[model samples]
Target: MSSLYDLAGPADAGAPGPSDPSDPSDPSGARDVVAFARVAAAAGLGARWPGQVALLGPGAAGAAAGSLLGGAVEPASLDLSAVLDRSAAGGLVDVEFDDAAAVRAGLACGGRASILVQPIGALPPEVLSALAHRRPTAVLTRLDDPALPTRAPAPPGDPAYGDPDSPDSLARSLLERGEPADAVAETASGRMLVSVYVPAPHLVVVGSGALATALGAQLALLGWSSAEVTGLDDALAAVDALGPGDGVLMVDHSADVDGPVLARALRGGVGYVAALGSRRTQAARRERLRAIGVDEASIERLRGPAGLDIGSRTPAEIAVAIVAEMLSVRASTSGAALRDTTGHLNAGRP
Candidate 1:
């Protein structure tokens, strides 16, 4: 990253953003992450899409990521127990992870030793969203601690290995390979704590208008991506244009038009479907949707008010709440910024 220009030549150059000067919500620092990653990938490193996972544990996180590389390429562990030095492809780097170090290095936690896994390519959509918005995410990693009785924890209904509390071996391996698994689990006995600083959730906001614009700016800070989709037809078309793991947020809901768009979106297997409207308007729309067989479950995920219940007044505030809700539901957790605490965590990786 010292000479990022040597990487991809600016990706079209808009000034390497360090988003704002002091705002923790700025996306600039996040850009540093992307630049370094892209450079590494361009250099032919073993990093790739969805970004990378920075494991927090002993040699665990490193071993986990290296294992994820697949094929027969085993990760070389440079335990701090040895002197740090430069070598060929199989060289070693001396480093140590701790609570204070986590904050300083932006790894995960202070007390835990971690592996900072960074994808060598474009980060996963979720990580990108988190970066753009400056939100915290939960990550799970394993422990060599003797406190746990040595049994793999039950799969917490989440494919992310297990809960972000304790990650299973499979989760660590996948994360190392650059696939973004939602949760990670260790087991019933392992030390459990979620790594935070996950990128914000992204929402492709289709349709242009006051709402779209307002939402875009607001979501940008809430750790959500708010892209504008102009019309119902355009929105529907965009849905088809999306790849797997993409999410959409639609505004300007005209029953006759948006309803069909919603149907197409649902059928397309989009993750989150939301529209903006007044209470009465949303209720009536729901009734009509059921009449057309849109189903109660999908309808339930639909946020009529489209935001957390913070009683936001301005369009900007409302937009914040909406994007916040999108992130909450996307992670399947209640709304609470992850930066202030150290309970659950996930690293945004390739």
Candidate 2:
């Protein structure tokens, strides 16, 4: 393992870090990444949490941050790919791009790019933790003498990264968008990259059968946290947890078991609400909801026979289809085939 200096300022030793940076057990920063990810995931980091990547240093050159936006560990492929095809192998570069294609794709607001690309695993534990739990986190990397470090240090106090209480905190300002606040600001240390990671929307799965079980498992694989509601009580309780970035799914076989929960979830203004069943079953359920005074608008919000037209057969496959549709709703995509779709693959990321 390569040894290097600290990239971020020194933080207090008592902060909520996964591993002690000064520990002798793992000096290579390997254990901290694993430990931080483990703790953050356990704390309910939403599925859409992007990777923790930081681009630090004075403006210089040819690197794109597309990977950072998509939560990938590596840097993005720059438009100047022909110039420095292997420059990023070391993860730090100072080349300039010919066009702002990468910026248009969703990155820091500029065409001129020169920065040290910090690996996602090397992000500070505080930033990583905030990202894991969907807390709004602003990564302020000092760029005076930018250097990639083998060990990423937690930033010392000043601008609170994830502190919700501070009015001037970037966390408060970054709440307006789900995607990163791609911009650069002049800081005391020099130019800094201010990338914000907002929490992904929550998915609440209602029911207690094999479908629900498969749904929960599938969501976990996506790094998303979901609440499983098996009864009216659980469903009502889950409504309190619903926010603008949350949705609900009904998978129970009985309307008696799924209707009340679905009604409450829809009324709560969740982003997506879907129920599994056949088309005929959906129509019957719609009428039943109408009889209960669910109204046309609310009834319109419900997506019965949930999931895309993937012809899925098993519970696991159905779960995939449903999640796919939910993802499409979140991305504002038509849920159409990618081949049929035009434009950048990562457009409209939130």
Candidate 3:
């Protein structure tokens, strides 16, 4: 069987051609969804087929495949030839894997998983757009009515899913927890499969120095992306372009460069905004920001002195600490050590 990457197209094709968006180097996985949507559209799957095509994998890992679009499922290990044929006909199939079979299927463990091989017409265009843009999104599928699933952007203030009185409030809560995994949620209406998709964290590093270089390398090692900028225009543009799952790190201590960028990021929806400075420098920066009319609430969102107190003196060490803090913030955790905490270590993790 051919991998989805193989069937999609070349990874590095020239502009205007379909290419493998599932390339490992992309990090965000947004490319995968975009490419799948493009390919599906090109093949006339949406028009020829009764409904939209997509894949829904099983477990908290969230592996799913559909008529032509593959979600998180690896198309290589599981022979999808038969599944694809069935999905093209708008048929639903429940695929279960034994322990050994699961291993062969590239799953971490084995269990009965009902892969949704149906039309995804119910999914909104906005949801798909959010996924393609590397924004947080959730797909809530009612187990009883699996054919017509609903979607919502996973940000806290989104009106579509944020109302506590909504039937899928439980699913919204799961999504708000910021866990990028599949979960079974019992709602007021029925049981639902909440599949949360979060883009890999991207950071805007505002400065060029040994510290900035180290941070870039560190982000790459973590399967994340970072862009370095020094000019105020570039810095502001990057900060403005950030989504709820991305961040900006102002490593340049210059007030002229850092002030406007920090104000923009703090007021915007960027998930994390941090800066590299000493305690005194942080105080000075705050005063400068306040003088420039930045509100107290927005200024408080800044994670100045950027990283955890990990005794990181070297540039590389600082990068590790900063990245660790960023992950902790993304996960909505206190950055405490596992030993110091009393709950399941892997709880809410994929």
Candidate 4:
């Protein structure tokens, strides 16, 4: 039998294997996604769609609910049982959906969707692991355009090819931008699809107060994860739990709690650190941090009274405001109203 990647030479042909995600040097975790997409494209699988194979899974409404195969033998027509069969042999297939047929199936509420079919093992283990852990990642896919070369001469944003100053590395740029989600862009090479995976921010609330509880519940509603640290001694471990994009909410307000916790957070490189307090309180905290040897720059990073100026009164309202501020910081936005911002709304986006 011919291999799925036969058209692309071999899976590990002359091309370089994907970089190790465990390597601390490659923190983006996009290398595997790029490698797999490249393989699929070279193999001419889903040539039009590049890296994906769609399956007509649930939420598909229409008249032809049972005719999922659409009387076709293409990979997309494979049913659940067939998919299981293919997986047993390490096969990947694409399932296409016909909206009209679905509408005819007498299903009024379900919508049409194509599922990307593949064995769990076919995917890069690193990408899967990162997703399981809610780490921030981006998947950059280059389309097969007859007009363009088979491979891009250089990674986007690289200094190669006479433009050392160009910061066009698509993967890096995407990582620098907003929440991980699907985005499209036209590049010098061709059109590209970027599937960004921004794991929900894990909020570390360093307090057992009502505000901390409310914040945890609110984060849950947003599908974000939160770790609550009630005691001062536990603050360090909680602060250490934060990854690159995670945040620290110091609502505990006790110098005993905030002092060591804030110092550790600043030193450890948490994305956001905010304490609940007034201006005078923040000043005092700053002084305390300095005495503990926390530098001025790190002290400056703290957002005391952490929240937007929406005039929050209750604990719930405060939670909303603080979360909003953290989100704004994460997105690198000023938290201003969208109506007030000018220029292409998605200028920096893919």
Candidate 5:
């Protein structure tokens, strides 16, 4: 199914200018939401407008909405023809999907969705900038009141959170979860749609080998980004810049090089810190870290011998296992088989 990652720019002349969300021209050179925002901005939908531009809400099965610029939806797969037909004059459109309809629409489950189909812009420049720059951003929309302006995406310090029942407070709550997700909330103003966009998982690979090459391929396949660094200074810089959603994979197998980088990552906000080594190597590395003043609590965060017990041997297979483990860690799961567990299949998914 077409996802946000598969969105392409319009090809026809006079249509919204063509844009590749994964273009290398991006400053980060990573395929992220910033590229998506660039597409919307290039199409002239990032600002307030009274023209024919509209927005399709709840992007990717009610995760977040994307702009419908020049009659093209940036990141939508659902058949919005009926909704668009009804909202041709530019207004609000709410859509509800039953189990069968939702499944047909490529949604994982059935639910009701409210899509804002008006020419009125949904995102302000500040909000777009935050998303483009990989900052934690939350977009709040009043579904019931199209006349009311959509609240700008804000960080946790915004005064809008002063009101408990305000949409901004609800958005802040979602942002605090530190994961990208969207939901509908009951606010004092009315029913509001809040979507949180966080930095995509950026992995720092601190080694060079077949494994590193395989890891890069896997990261690209997942639409995530990675930086390959060998120097201790570059590695440390990458770890220090990592956000809560980012990660580090150390495969250099050098105690002197790995200890400081791993220590900094564990002590900082980097979400996943892993290393490649055997049992003896892991123990020796731990001791080295201790000698360097890394606390026990911080050291415990290291996932030495990275990757699940998938009995992988080849570089590609090991890469799969490592990437799988990284995803499990991100989801707060135990890398267990679905048949071996209970409850929702996607319970831990962001």
Candidate 6:
């Protein structure tokens, strides 16, 4: 009854060194793939490996372009200009037949090294979902055969469209739709590569309203997880549809529609809660909550006027401003443009 995660020891199991046994540095047990890049760059291996996948192991980080290349070629001769071929982000591993190329990757590009491709074997659905939420996953490719089904976390949501004989495999689960899972290892030996979509950061917008719709559209372009809802029912549905590292963004422009929704969403441990309204509108709503015994401390987290004050006049402009603010929050920026910025207090003298 154990998941593939439990069996394969997570994606970075084959990575270097002993992990911190006292306390896990990351909330997700899987390594932080982005951090792996910096580590590889620092290890003097980034420039030495031919084509290798550096596995950073659990509670650590993902691999770097250098580590992946190390797996493909000799680790003692990593160089900068070795014709590096990289893949898109998320924990992706590439298995190549060529043992004489420099395989490097940047943050967000996940192509595992060339060893474990074909025999990745079967994984549980929920485990795949859990794996998709910031978990590092290793994928194997058979450089010999290509009719193998490569397994990855199911695409974040249901099929965008369901049609039989549509030839579109979006509806087919990642491990089931294509080449049979049984052939994964064999096909790779024939020159096919399999990549796993390690769970990346995503945001889930629970609530179907103008705000929800707008947020969904905007966040999609930003590569964040988002969904919409008209009522609490829809909100629940959206939450049910999302994976981890994902949260419910309830944009309640209408108090009548948002009051209970906001309360419930907050109680559900939503990471970001911002209601679309003015200070007074939010205050009035807060008082309404007080009347119902919701404490001031619990209600204070609400970000009213939800976005940064950018003098936005139109709904579309306002939507852009809100998304920008959210991105700023995510990136830990001051929401100030570089063109208008003064000295950065955090910048140290060279």
All models: lDDT? 0.44, 0.52, 0.60, 0.54, 0.61, 0.41
Q: lDDT tens digits, residues 199-234, model 6?
A: 333455544446556666777686454545565555
lDDT of 5 by residue, 289-334 (tens): 9999999988888998999999999999999988999998888888
TM-score of each: 0.45, 0.50, 0.64, 0.59, 0.60, 0.44
Best by TM-score: 3
Native-to-model Cα distance after best TM-score fit, residue 242 in candidate 3, in Å: 2.3
Query: Which 10 residues in a row give candidate 1 its minimum summed lDDT?
Result: 35-44
- Runs with alpha carbons beyond 4 Å of true place in candidate 1: 1-169, 172-200, 222-224, 242-246, 336-350
C-alpha displacement of 28 in model 2, angstroms? 34
| Model 2 regions more than 4 Å off | 1-177, 180-184, 187-197
Among the numbered candidates, top lDDT falls to 5
Question: Pairs clashing in candidate 5?
Answer: 59-64, 59-65
Ranking by TM-score: 3, 5, 4, 2, 1, 6
Off by over 4 Å in 5: 1-71, 74-135, 141-165, 176-179, 182-193
Please give, for residues 128-173, the per-residue lDDT of candidate 2 as tens digits: 4443323455554444433523222224464444454432254345
What candidate 3 gets wrong by more than 4 Å, as runs, is: 1-73, 76-101, 104-112, 117-122, 129-135, 142-167, 184-191, 220-223, 331-350
Q: CA lDDT of 237 in candidate 3?
A: 62
Backbone clash count for every predicted candidate, in the order shown: 43, 11, 8, 24, 2, 56
